[model samples]
Target: MTSKTIASSEPSIIESIDQLFLRFIVGKNKIYKEEEYNDGLSEAEQDDKELGLPAAEEKSGWNQRILLEVEKDRVKRVEADKRLKDKRNALLMRYFQQSLLKVVNDKLENSESVISDQLQLRENTVELLKKLLAGEPRYSVLASLLELNPGTRNRLLSLVSSEDFMKALGRDPRNVRDIQTAIGMIGTDVLRFLVPAILFKYRINAYSHHNTLFAKKLWRYEMTLGQTCTALMHDINYRRPYEGMLLSAMVNFAYVASYQQYLSSFEVVRTACLDQAREKGEKNRHDFFYDIKTDSASLQALLVSQADLKLSLALSEKLFQKSFPHLVNALKEEVEGLAYEERTTVGKILFKAVRFAKYDQLRSSRLFKPEWQDDYLADSYIEQDVFKNLLRQELFRFKPTWS
Candidate 1:
């Protein structure tokens, strides 16, 4: 047969079986040779050789490579975690910003509707004061001086004639100059009495266009504070309810000043609260929005530096020194010597009164506790029999006409 023809032909079964046996023997011999070579080493080295582990010298290199891979994975995971946390924080910030913007816009939209109501309440308060003071001859004279309405002036004049007015003034006027002097003296006293009310009225007008609800609420709060302070002062035999009134009225003067500058005061307060929260850590996080202690401290500072009340100058200075030592050096030149106990007593009562008013407002509005708890006036101090009785009486008598 030709060679091509012979190759094309199939092999016999015996020939194929022989070829398969030859391939199997060759593979088995190679494995036997490796086993025979491993037999020369000790049991541990044989196991190591079987497992294909590196020698000690090369072990470090292998470990380093493994560590490099692990480190790489750790870094990737850490970066991913950081990205996730940043995304979460950004979303939270956006939500808070939207919420704040909505609140601001709502306040603006509803301002006009509420302004007339606030004005009506203010007018009602003024009328109530007029009625309360009508019986006093001095007040009648003061009313005549301040009254712009012709009919009201005539009515007040009729109630107090020139003779009665002069007697009340404790002056026997012989000439126009004497009469003018008597009128001026009475006017000064009237102005002193009217200062709180005047401030209240001015704030109502000034803030109506800016934040009507806040203006009304602030006026109410001041009134409540003034009344409470007056009662507390009388109970403690402080003998100066008017001074208490002035002090309480001036508590939010800084806020008013801030309003004048387009709510810069709120920003200052907000920043201060945030700074305090960061310093105090998570436990005091709520303080970032409404810290009562900070409010009291700021108010005390303003009273010392800006309230301009001679009677309170010494007391305010002492309060500032005790409550805010950091400010002492800057204010030392302005501080006057005063009794520490007296200043402390005044500060406690003032702080409690403001806190109570804030709390009462929150409660009346049916607001949540956390929203106002930072400004909470602890009942621990104000719940005593003396304070409790006085607050109860004042609250009962308190009539917020504008609500």
Candidate 2:
């Protein structure tokens, strides 16, 4: 009966001790054991407690929750970084465009001084420069203006019409009232476009028929220049764009000078988009490079380099035709259709044709007289009072002899 039946052969004391030690360690982490697990219970209580099960499960759950939260934070940070990068790129592009416009405006402002030095005229001496060198209206004013001191030109340009003053200075007459009362006052010059000086020139030139010749001529010059500016501002491919725009702007400024109805016309053209302006510009492109050949940058640059001279020559021809037709005809044989109205439009349409046509011969022909020289002729007797009185008489008498 006493056959060593030790309660189902209880495991060795060492094995029991090992299990108990494992229980204690797990409970120490607060997973398997309560705060007072040992207060009233020993090995018997541990056997019924089930301490290790729930704590092990909960610890694993907490680790997974921490990992998920960290991943979410990382995603939020990535989105924030992306937004900052886009904002920086937009600001830089606008700065470049403004710089280009500023440079253009500055050069135009300096155009007056350049004209003065080139003409070899004294800074303040009055001179009557014709408005046309050929059939087209001459930008002779523009050319002459380039030689005058920019400061003086700009200063006078602001005070009144420099063209009028120059005319007066040349002993041409101008009217003060007419200049003051005219409509349209978008002034680009340093002075008011309708200054007394400008009116003086208008008065002298506005006389009827033959007497109105100079005034009409100056007006046409303004229109031609306005057309040019319209072309340059709208035509992306326009050849010699800078010079053309400058010429055009100067002319538009002149209209502002005369206080002519042309101011509205100039604005209409200026506000038009490229598509509409192209139609108008097409008519004026005959003299200079109207556009770059297709899209060739090299060709475009070349055209720009020669633009000023080529345009000047073309304008010279136009001015000469109006200012001195016999001279133009004497210089070269007239084309068969040139006198026809239809052919006149054709002449404009095919301005480039001049490069290859008989007109080229005329354009390239040498001047037969010193009076017909390409340079501006200076007349020293041009006086403001004499010019103003003449202008008043011309305006009052539609056919005044002195005008």
- lDDT against the true structure, per candidate, is 0.42, 0.29
The count of backbone overlaps in candidate 2 is: 47
TM-score of each: 0.35, 0.18
Model 2 C-alpha lDDT per residue in residues 1-403, reported as the tens digit of each score: 0012257667532233223322332121222322343422454345334322223355475464443687667756654653453343223223322333333323323334323322122433223222211112223443354245343334333433435444443433322322222111212221222222232333223443321333443343333332222232233353322222223222123222222212222233233323453667743332212221111122122223322233233323433345434323322221222322333322222221211111111112221222422221111121344333322332221110111
Q: How many collisions per candidate? A: 0, 47
- Residue 89 local lDDT, model 1: 46
Mark the 10 consecutive residues where model 1 has the least summed lDDT.
Answer: 21-30
TM-score of candidate 2 to 2 decimals:
0.18
Tens-place lDDT digits, model 1, residues 1-403 = 0011145467432233222222221121222222243312454566555544446777575354454788667757765775675576445445434444343334323333222232222443334333433323354554444453333334333323456544655644333323234335445344343434544446445454434554555566666766676666666776444444455534544344333322333455456546765787844343425432112222222323333233223333433334334223222221232222333566656645654655454444443244433323232246557545655665523321111
State residue 354's C-alpha deviation in candidate 1, in Å. 2.0
RMSD of each: 35.2, 38.4
- Which whole-number lDDT from 0 to 100 does residue 241 have in model 2? 24
lDDT of 1 at 119: 23
